[model samples]
Target: MRVLLCTFIQIVMWCGYSIVLFLSHHDHNFYETILMLMFGYFNFLVAQRLNINKSVALNMTISLTLIYVTGKMIIG
Candidate 1:
């Protein structure tokens, strides 16, 4: 289904973002910010397409935080 596909894509994106964030050294750098923003924006689009936009911010934040912590631990 579309939802499943979207969710899978989001997870892949999150992992990719985390990997880049780990490699970037400066987590708060412009590149990382852009990556996060893009992920968030793309996530929002997916939610909007699914008519579930309201929870996008919360979901994105939670996922971002969790992935970030995981990435830190993984690549530390």
Candidate 2:
């Protein structure tokens, strides 16, 4: 249950972050990178508390990277 909730929160947060960045015309500046990293850190905390496997963190990083890269490609 906790794992599911953590996954859901992570997905929602990523989507919200991406939407905000897209709408704001962000240029992937320092602040945007910091915000992204913060979200990753938050996910780490939640996953840790839920006693989830470490691979979840890797998966989150990979997933976010892919989404960000794909969005950049499509937007450009």
Candidate 3:
């Protein structure tokens, strides 16, 4: 459940950022590289805060990534 919530937050963080960037110039893929690192950092934070295993953190990050992708699709 905590993992799932982290995923949601991850998606929301990216989506909110993407939308704001999109408003300026529509460079959607521009944020991917940065988000990759961000996700890594976030996963570390998740592991620390949630005291979860690496696998759980990774899976949760993936779920969150999916949310970002789907959100952009739905919104755009």
Q: Judged by lDDT, which candidate is best?
A: 2
TM-score of 2: 0.61
For model 2, give the 10-residue run with minimal summed lDDT. Answer: 57-66
lDDT of 2 by residue, 16-56 (tens): 88787778774658878787788777767767777777887
Q: What is the lDDT of residue 26 in candidate 1?
A: 58
TM-score of 3: 0.53
The 0-to-1 C-alpha lDDT of every candidate, in the order given, reads 0.68, 0.73, 0.65
* lDDT for residue 76 in candidate 3, whole number 0-100: 79
**How do the predictions measure up, each by TM-score?**
0.51, 0.61, 0.53
Q: Residue pairs in steric clash, candidate 2? A: none
Ranking of candidates on lDDT, top first: 2, 1, 3
Better of 1 and 3 by TM-score: 3
Cα lDDT tens digits for candidate 1, 11-70: 777788767766887566676768778777776676566765567545754675567657
State which candidate, 1 or 2, has the greater lDDT.
Answer: 2
For model 3, what is the alpha-carbon lDDT of residue 37?
61
Candidate 1 lDDT score at position 25:
74
